[model samples]
Target: MKQSGNSLIEFLLVTVVILAVTASILALAGQTDKKRVNEELSDLATLTATAERALGMPQGHYEGLPGKLIDEKLVPAKMVDSAGHLQSRWGPVNLVPIDVGAKRLAGYSITYTNVPSPACPLLVKGGPKDKRSIRVDSVEVGSFGNINASALAQACSKATVSITFEHHLNEPGKRSL
Candidate 1:
């Protein structure tokens, strides 16, 4: 009579195959996340610089103000990402209204935004104390390319790509909730 030794060997082989498949899946997932993180970092750098640069020039009540940095030259009306999310091609990364505390017409506040602001919140009114405050939405990068459309359009989308922004209020004491 044949022993059941063959059954044990078959079981070992199946286990090995399962482990290999699992390992492969985990590796792929990791690679994808890495790629996304890198992309988010790089993209954020570009957007932040661009937005900051735009803050340099003085703007009018209705007319758009100039940027602090114009790498490509001239503010664009809008900029679209690979997924079609847009930034103002010509305007600031994002816009904020004149605040009451502002020393000038507007103070561009890019420090608070770690990454570039999103394409939405067309206009953000400044705080009562500061006139020159523009709040660019935070940009988040996820492993997946399809960030929710609303998030892409709005700064608060909460994409996987997270950013920490820093800001120094011109009139912190005057700020209201």
Candidate 2:
């Protein structure tokens, strides 16, 4: 009877230790994810600044901006994989020109696809504030002004999401909203 009681206690202790270790590992993983998300946001900010500089140049347009950025080595090396394709934390990063009107390419849009739902709010909240518009899965959640947190949260409630950051040129060599 005494040996059985000791064995039971040992089993309970080992189970408790296992549970604690699992909890610690989960917490550490959460922290790591947060750190990675912050890194991605920083990279996005750098890319946006680079695009703005390109827009301010003599051409003053977004035509072929993605290729230009890649060819000129303006994009951060970390964002590009071995195949030279831009990648975000969750998936591919696409940079394309935005046609304002009359076949005029006046701006650029950065789209990050296959984004996990939890990262949606973080991306929107931490994204560049000077963007002309922000969209989640083809729905415009914010534009030319402060983004509504509630709207963003609602829009981002999905298994996977796509976020687009659109930057527009108000005039030649000038950025607006």
Candidate 3:
């Protein structure tokens, strides 16, 4: 019996199926990456917001802790959730993640919320630090997981993200979303 080669339509169908599977896999990976980036941003924002809130705490406010900041030996890490609740006492609040780090945790960085910031580089008529407003630069947040500062920056860069906090104080846009 003469052998018959596979039809063109059959080959095309197989190719299409293979391409579809590959595309789906790629799309899933991309989505996962995006989720990671967003999570990182959210964590960073939370960490910073907590710090700002701490500073805003009424001067006379008192808590059971000897020092409101936590760390008895030093200033504690100002940490809070998105709704404005303190989380950590003296560690990377959420940005670097509690479980992160090998020799150290990955993807972390601290930026100090600038007081009377220079002005939003992207906004117009952004005033000066005293009476003006601008986005905050890098803040001295605690550490990444248990890692140092530089390592955190390296981990977060993969998502084209830079951890930072908003200096929302006595103004309309103080808290982050």
Candidate 4:
């Protein structure tokens, strides 16, 4: 009886350790995935801003939607996927063109919504939370043109140019892991 009790306790101990280690590894993987997705989102935002600046530079005024600009060759096609959609690890990014009125161009803002995979665990907070969309309302686009500071300020005040991403969180491949 004494020997059987000891064997059972030992088995339980080993099982607990294995479970703990597996949990830690999965958590780490999730963190890494979140970081990668965030970086991709930032890159897309930067590219959009730069492309808009390029379009606005020649005319001393930047106006029109990103898609239109791309069609005009002002923005590169490489900036978006073959489907003409900007994509991140989380999913497709959509550009919401804020009309650049007769006013100057200020900065813009960004927001993201992620639909996590059922196969994966819940993501951590303060990054891209699972199944939730977060908006970074104010992203300032500085004066890329020769416009005056006052005009820039006015544009900033009234500008509605922004971007958003919404998609399912696809799982990384074995090589990525």
lDDT of 2 by residue, 1-177 (tens): 999999999999999999999999999988877887899999999888888786645554787767777878898888887887888878999988878776478778999999888788888888987777899988888876478778788889999999999877774444453
In candidate 2, residue 123 scores what lDDT? 86
Question: Which stretches of candidate 1 lie above 4 Å from their native place?
Answer: 1-3, 57-84, 87-164, 167-177
lDDT of 1 by residue, 1-177 (tens): 145788888889999999999999999976765554454344445554444444433332212322323334443323443433334322223333233344444333332232323322211211112222233344441111223334435654433222223222233443311
lDDT of 2 at 160: 91
Alpha-carbon runs more than 4 Å astray in model 2 = 171-177
Residue 119's lDDT in candidate 2: 83
Model 4 has an lDDT value of: 0.42
Q: After superposing candidate 3, which stretches have Cα over 4 Å from the reference?
A: 1-7, 56-177
TM agreement with the true structure for every prediction: 0.42, 0.89, 0.36, 0.47
Top of the candidates by TM-score: 2
Candidate 3 has a TM-score of 0.36
For 1-177, candidate 3 gives per-residue lDDT tens digits of 223355666788999999999999999976765554344345444433443345334331122222333443223233443544334322232222111223222112233222111111211121112211211234232221122335434333332222242232233433322
**Best prediction by lDDT:** 2
Best-to-worst order by TM-score is 2, 4, 1, 3
